[model samples]
Every structure is written in structure tokens, then in C-alpha cells.
Target: LGLASCKNNTETLGSPLPLNKNYFENYLNARYNEEADYDPNSPANILREVHGLNKQGKLITQVSMFANRYPSEDALKLFGANEGVGAQLPQ
Candidate 1:
């Protein structure tokens, strides 16, 4: 019964989304200087940095939510992806 319940729960959750490689790459490029000591390719390192930053009491504003919701190429380009990491968003 326990095993069946677990299977049902897993089925309900469905599969996780695939990692957005472009987002990761662009994010890495932008934050590389800020995390120079850690290996950008290491998932553990990336998670650690992100978690650390989040723990610093970062608040989620509406603009951030909007950016996350539309992280496609067009959105990224609008944020100056061509200008490289840490580029300022268009006014």
C-alpha cells in the first residue's frame, strides 16, 4: 500500500522541466566575476552560490517575477544578452 501511494504521488508530480542551458550559460557569464572562486560548471557550486545569495534576504519583486516567467531568447535579448553578463536592462 505504501509503495502504491508513492507511485501515485510521483505520477501526479510529473517530470521536471529540462534545464535551460542558455539561461544557465548566460547567467554564468554574467555572475562569473562575482563567483570567481567556484567552478561554473559544477552544479553543486552553482546551487551553493544561488542559495547563499537567496539567504541574504533578497526580496522577489514583480519585475523579477516577470523576467523569470519570460526567459525566452527574445526576453533575454531585450535584457541585453548581446552585451554579455551583468549588462544593464534597457530603460
Candidate 2:
């Protein structure tokens, strides 16, 4: 992540999106105590797998797929749990 100049005096900084990937990996590693089986349906797995790709579009797509596969309430709960309160999944 790098800083960039914006039109205004305020500057734009690189996003800390990769932190989500790191957090997911750490959670899985700790929970499983070893390499966990790859679960495509798992949001953590999706984030971990896509982390290296460094493509925001791809990451968003994977998250969308995960949300689509589950009920809205379940998805929202899972998202909020991982991403913190009031974090809304894309519609």
C-alpha cells in the first residue's frame, strides 16, 4: 500500500485491506492447529486464497459469492463478526 496525491490538500493512503487476509489466516492457523482443509464456502478461506492476488475486484467477488451462498441474516452475522459491528455486506 502506497500513498497517493489527491486533488484536494488531503492525501489518499493505500488501503489496509490485506489486514483482513492476515487476520483470517491467523484465525485458521490457530483454530486448526495445522493446515486446515480448503473450504471454498468459507469466507476466511476465500480471503486467504485471494490475498496474494492483490485485486480488490476479485476479493469483492469472492466475498459476494460467499454472501450469496448463505441466508442474508447468516451472511450479515458472519460478516459483522469478522469485520466488526455495522459492517454491511454489499447488496
Candidate 3:
């Protein structure tokens, strides 16, 4: 995430882009403790996971992940609980 200067500044910062190079290969190297993907094929599960991940607690982590250009969260918010670690930092 080092600063770089290019003659062209047409590209917007933070625009969602695909990882098209090896440079980003290690970005998720420290990302661990992924929350369970409850039911990959179930629409209900997909919605639930999205809903859970967008809750305030999880949203904080999501924000950091994007802002910092990496998975910065150290823990996962419980699916439906108020407070508890559902998972831990990447190992």
C-alpha cells in the first residue's frame, strides 16, 4: 500500500478492481478465522450471512478491510449474539 505517483490521475482511488497481478497475492496472507459459510447454495443462508456481516460490529471490520486494503479484523461477531467471538484473527 505504498504511495505512488503516475502521470495520469484519471483513475479513481478505492475503485473496486479485480486482482490482476501477483502484487496483490499476499494481501490476504494474514486473513484467518473466516466465519462459516452456513449454506453456500441456500438463498436464505446467503441473505443471513450478508445480514450478519453488515451488522454494526461486523461492518466495522468490513470498513477496515476496505480502508486498509486488507482483512484487518481480528474477530468475528457472533451470528445472532450481542457479544462474543465467533472466530479469531487469521493464523
Highest lDDT scorer:
1
Q: List candidate 2 stretches off by more than 4 Å.
A: 1-68, 83-91
Each model's lDDT comes to 0.45, 0.43, 0.39
Backbone clashes in model 3, listed as residue pairs: 32-90
Error of 2 at 63 (Å): 23
For candidate 2, report its TM-score.
0.16
lDDT of 2 at 80: 37
Whichever of 1 and 3 has more TM-score, that candidate is: 1
lDDT of 2 by residue, 1-91 (tens): 9988676453433333323444455555543122334446566656766785432222211121221233344444554343433464665
Cα lDDT of model 1 by residue, 2-86, tens digit: 5433442333324333346676565555421122243455666567677774222223322212234435654555444434334
Clashes of each: 1, 0, 1
TM-score of every model versus the real structure: 0.18, 0.16, 0.15
User: Judged by TM-score relative to the true structure, which candidate is superior, 2 or 3?
Assistant: 2
Worst 10 residues of 2 by lDDT: 59-68
RMSD of candidate 1 to true structure, Å: 19.5
The residue pairs that clash in candidate 2, if any, are: none
